[model samples]
Target: MGTTLLGIDTKEHCFEAQFHPKRPLLACACITGEVELHHFDRENRTHELAQSITSHSKSCRAAKFLTDSILASTGADKFAALSDLETGKQVWRCKLKAAGYSLLALDTERFAIGDDDGGLRIFEGRAPKAAVSWSENTDFISDLAMGVDGTSLCAVSGDGTLAVYDVRKSGEKGLIAMSDFQDDELLSVAILRRGTKVICGTQTGVLPIFSWGDFGDQKDRINGHSMSVDAMVKLAEDSIITGSSDGKLRVVAVHSKSLHSQILGILGEMSAEYPIERLSLSPDASTLACSSHGRPSVQLWSTEAARRLMEGESWESIFEVPDEGAEGEGAKADPTAAESDDDSSEEEQPKKKRRKEKKKGKKNVPGSNAKQHQAAKFFAGL
Candidate 1:
């Protein structure tokens, strides 16, 4: 079956969309200061409106569902909100001195927020106390992602800095300061394979992967797309999926060095042509939720299709050009003459080819004259 837009809100301008960990529906929030919940059936690829919430005074940037039908959202108005999913009611909101950009639910009671003043704050569940707070940066944190077990946090700030913090430690565990590039902002981050490696997205279209717990080790940069990498999500233990401002979702196989990408655009532009803002994978590895800014679209992809693409045979033909089309194969493939040329070229070319190859090479060989003189002296001595 084909995919369908289950529902859309012209007023909300959805920026991020996330699914309930155990439920069949998804939730989203908008830059126009509203939140919405959507119910979907992937089997039929249909979406329906579940709820529309207007809780914040300013634009809401991030939202995620906690357990027990509870939701949490952050906005540009320096507030972190806790809501009831079924009732669409705000239970509590903790105010911060600076505007908050990202919300990560640690548990039903505790959550983490990255603020505009380059601060990382962890708030207690259902309480007013701060669990732990650190300001290791002087710039606003653009994106924050927690490890699978919630023991490690990866934060990328607006200053093009990426740092990982160990939450279990009483003091500091250390940090990996990533390389900065000109005219690029750190857009997003993700943890791979239970925090064994870290991936960071940048505005200049580079995805840098770092080994966990290895300070000062240079990261392996994966050059993927031509525009800003807005979101990255781990699909499996060995693979990742990225959504970009270029309106494409790319699955990168780290182990196999294979890539499967689809452009949802037309004429060398992102097809469906929306600016993809975020990506989130289901906990069971069955679905991918994509959120967009330009079209305010939330698209779900089949996890099985994603897995097949990741495990499929290599796609090396995308770079090659056939010498002849199938219609001209008979004229191009003189089987007997081609075999004879192969044998004759192999036998006749080696010695003659050596003289021609070394004509310009002998002068640049590192120690060729010294070795030759040494060999001559040894022969004379013998």
Candidate 2:
């Protein structure tokens, strides 16, 4: 089925989940400020609980893997903390002026944090001093992402600003550029093509792409989902996957060789009632780990197949689509859909069959986490 459910869900809601970059580790932060770390055993297809940490006093909104043995987390507690995953010990803690909402690891010794009141702070190593702090009248920062080079940082604000900071310089010099392409809140921001094109997932179901250094009018807008886009992860340099509150996971093509981007297909999906909470890619980019409210804490699937499907391959051509009718209880195998006239003039993917299916059934769900946690015993091939 190309899917595996790992880790048991706790009573408290899990706000974020991540997979380690260089280790076989999966971690999640709950509303109760509890951080759970697990070891994924690809050989046995099982996950073992590695540690449960109570580092924050309140909800841990964001968590990212810094190193194989280090994790960074922030929440309503108004502090950012680094913990040793091996021992589940709090190694360093830095208090912010306001509640922390987003966290991004900038480099080996520097990390960035976004807070309520529209604040963005940068810290170097364990020093308590904020190497830099900057913000305008923007509302709480909804998301933060570092450029592939770690030399630039991009942040989305509650008000609709997508700002990029050049951390290479200190003080106000670091404030590079910003764009308010749409008035609606931008829930997510991602840098593509090194730092040329910046994409933001807006509240209005659109992914607005802006050229770096000059955030004027958007270069293009990718119509994504019906609901607010809550999370996104770059699948390949030119491809991305988005999770929305409307309960859909979409694979969209970007930075195409022809310079045209479009929705490739849907990977995994859920309902609005339990929107996806987080999405993590394994170190090898082979397995994708996902989390959603009221569902399993972790869901796994093959990235290779999703990639093939993105290239316009068929379900059977990729793998079995999962037959639910024959099994009666488990996922039923879906009938192979008739090929569509992809020659439609509209650039948008057609929703003709989707509209019909929608009229036939009803459901809802939540989103994914990017930049995950780390731990021991690397996931040995899945």
Candidate 3:
């Protein structure tokens, strides 16, 4: 068992892209403040650009689909907005004074927003009031993720500090401050192993894990990456999918009942020529999208088989194509390509004719406006 590479046709780079929890949808926040939502036609084995949402004034750092129809995005312009995916209308927008860089959608009225000035604010929906606010050093808060418990959250800082917050407690300290590992600034943080452990990726490719409530020492420290981790998302309870400055996607296996600390190997690594700016994974963990820095190029990887490999299977290569059953997805790529190179020597093909979708009599979902027009075409030739 190995990995399959899905080539997404796009000429835009996103800061981060995410798949809907229960829908066949992919949404990305682009560098130009335009959020692109894509619909994957699984029945037809095709995809189309569903909508291009332009609401932010600056580059959006994070975009996520709260429901199949509701989307949330945080921009560098110090604004966090919630949009109705079906109607394409901004439902609520929060304007912060500091430059906001990260966001996590809780419920309709609650969100965890991180800013460049090292501020993490939990505010009610549509209301400009803060319920819980936490700030560490002046380091920029790069990313924010919810703990498995649903009430607690973790905020990773540019100063290599991991701030844990339990909404139940109102103290400023909140409990633990893991500050020993300062090899480089931490960029991404993810809680794994059923929310019992906290794992973070650092600038120098260091993956450190801390037990819940006790962040004084690392439970396990895995190494081998030569660049900073730029994007990370949880693939499984014990597995983490990471994209780094070197454009490499790795399945880092943490300690668990069936596995030890291992680097299971690369999932969808391209040439290190272009650093990976953002990465997204489907709720089923079937699809993975990795965006490159300034190249306007992205790769969608299938991790179904890769999970098998992580489960202790051995494979020579995980770079096969799903439909063609080809030996290598990047077969035409130079063998000497960098960490995550691609097959870019091919010519672009004309757009595929629009296929009429299957009509269902049920009421349209909230994000149906996204289905009316194909905003952008990705992997037009694939």
Q: Identify the leading candidate in terms of lDDT.
A: 2
lDDT of each: 0.59, 0.65, 0.64
In candidate 2, what are the lDDT values of residues 178-208, reduced to their tens digit? 5533556677777777666778787666788
Whole-model lDDT, model 2: 0.65
Error of 3 at 25 (Å): 1.7
Predictions ranked by TM-score, top down?
Answer: 2, 3, 1
lDDT per residue (tens digit) for residues 44-109 in model 3: 557778888885877776787666778878776788888888788788787776767777878765
Candidate 3 or 2, higher lDDT: 2
TM-score of 3: 0.77
**Deviating ranges (above 4 Å) for candidate 1:** 1-10, 168-183, 256-273, 314-382
Candidate achieving higher TM-score, 1 or 3:
3
Better of 1 and 3 by lDDT: 3
lDDT of 1 by residue, 205-302 (tens): 77776666542223576763666677777777667777766566666655344442231111111233454667777678777777764444577765
Which regions of candidate 3 deviate over 4 angstroms?
A: 1-5, 9-11, 42-45, 168-178, 294-296, 317-382
